[model samples]
Target chain A: MPKVEFNVDRCKGCELCAVFCPQKIIKLSEGINKLGYHPATVKEMEKCTGCAICARVCPDCVIKVYK
Target chain B: MKVVFERPRALSDVTTHYCPGCTHGIIHRLVAEVIDELGILERTIGVAPVGCAVLAYNYLECDWQQAAHGRAPAVATGIKRALPDRVVFTYQGDGDLASIGTAEIVHAANRGERITVIYVNNAIYGMTGGQMAPTTLEGQVTATSPRGRDIKQAGHPMRMAEMLATLPGVSYLARVAVNKPANIMKAKKAIKQAFMVQIDDLGFGMVEILSTCPTNWGLQPAKAMEWVDEKMIPYYPLGEFKVPGEVK
Candidate 1:
């Protein structure tokens, strides 16, 4: 299984990662962060390939992947 | 667990001030990753331009110099000449480079300065609000050109990579965009190659990265990324215009 971690506070809630995710697992949290943006989080970690595509498209570099 | 992808050491942990969906952050990370991979952080000196990316020095941990508006190439040239052993590069925006610092870049490339240049072209002045830039597409509405950019008055958008490729001193010149995941990988490769050219002591190398300004473009971050594909790419096609020993 692969793991993806996000510095949620730094996320700009641009939703780019969610759109680019191949597995369609990342989603915005129901709550907002300090910046008042709905940061993205993984909904189904088991499906992630750890391709880092989410991280690559992130304008804020908020995600890191481990495989 | 072993780390497959993480932040690059060459990039500081400081949160950038770029607007939401702005691709400057993506481009910055690519450069930092290239610096880390090339093991040139210690010798890398970057010249920061006067635009939205002016705060680049704060995010990139390299020893950086602040260049006067539209003089990043000139400053980079001076730095490379003063420290020939060091790897010097300039990061400039479309407004700063294409509009204000055109002569500086033309001369720097013609002089064959052994330096890397990361040119971010968003086609609008992002820092001081959305103003029409030298690379703005024809009929694109912006703050300065509310009626849309008039081709008669503004002329066509400048294809800087191709224009700079004409110089005999150029070692490498490529135009890459950061609109999607695949393009991001290609952009990283191009940026790394540009730095390699400098390290190999080749002539001036530059990578013009088609970037996004979501706030200025008045579109979602993702849509702005698509704008690069649907709007910008047709006029400024992506390709390696020049390569060392390949072009005359």
Candidate 2:
């Protein structure tokens, strides 16, 4: 199972993960979080391979991956 | 694939305490890999600074010292002078290097000290609640500069690499990032070059890594990398800032 979590407040809205996501399942949300940045969302969790690549490339650590 | 991503021998088995997406873990691995590859793990002495990486001594397997806030350069200077044959490097952060230790770094480079400095410039201070740092960009908001860094009030971001490259004593200076694997490779090369310069008895060498402090910069892990690419790169452009004795 691929599981991802984001600490919404920590996100700074850089969006590097969206560019690197192999499955392209992640996207920034339309609504702003407490940090005033659109945090990433895993719209299609089935496509995730649990590679944690998105988590790895993120600089903010807002993303957490669990398999 | 038996084990391509195993930890380096120079790194201890203790799991890193860095926050998720914190590139400090990756940077530590890179340093340990270089130390292992150079066959200097036994002779290398690393100096840890007072920022997020203050506990680096705990993770790195080689001999280590914990220096006061922004004093890693001075400590490394002493260690190198006392043991010229050993490899000495200081791992420091933006706050440690660009702020309180500015004079130390400047004098160390100016004196041409035979040491290597791994300067991690994440723009904001990671520890102590994400305060605005000297490297924080203009209009880049932080805990201190909530309205964004005001050039009129806070002055402009400091370009440590460009500033030190111009000093006569600095023999090698480069700025690399860890936003991606390709960039990580570049950072590794630069790090190796720094240590190789030290081994050759070359003068001062420093590699300023434009790292992402996702926790401090108020960005998600992925976005922090994006921020690095979109914002940080333009201000602190990467490349060899200074390299003396080149054939070219």
Using DockQ, give the best candidate's number: 1
* Segments of candidate 2 deviating more than 4 angstroms: A1-67, B246-248
Model 1, stretches more than 4 Å misplaced?
none
- lDDT, candidate 1, B76-147, per-residue tens: 999999899999999999999999999999999999999999999999999999999999999999999999
Error of 1 at B99 (Å): 0.5
Where is model 2 chain B poorest over a 10-residue stretch in terms of lDDT? B1-10
TM-score of chain B of each: 0.99, 0.97
DockQ of 2: 0.12
In model 2, chain B matches the true chain B with a TM-score of 0.97
Q: Each candidate's lDDT (Cα)?
A: 0.93, 0.84
Poorest 10 consecutive residues by lDDT, candidate 1 chain B: B239-248
Quote the TM-score that chain A achieves in each candidate. 0.96, 0.91
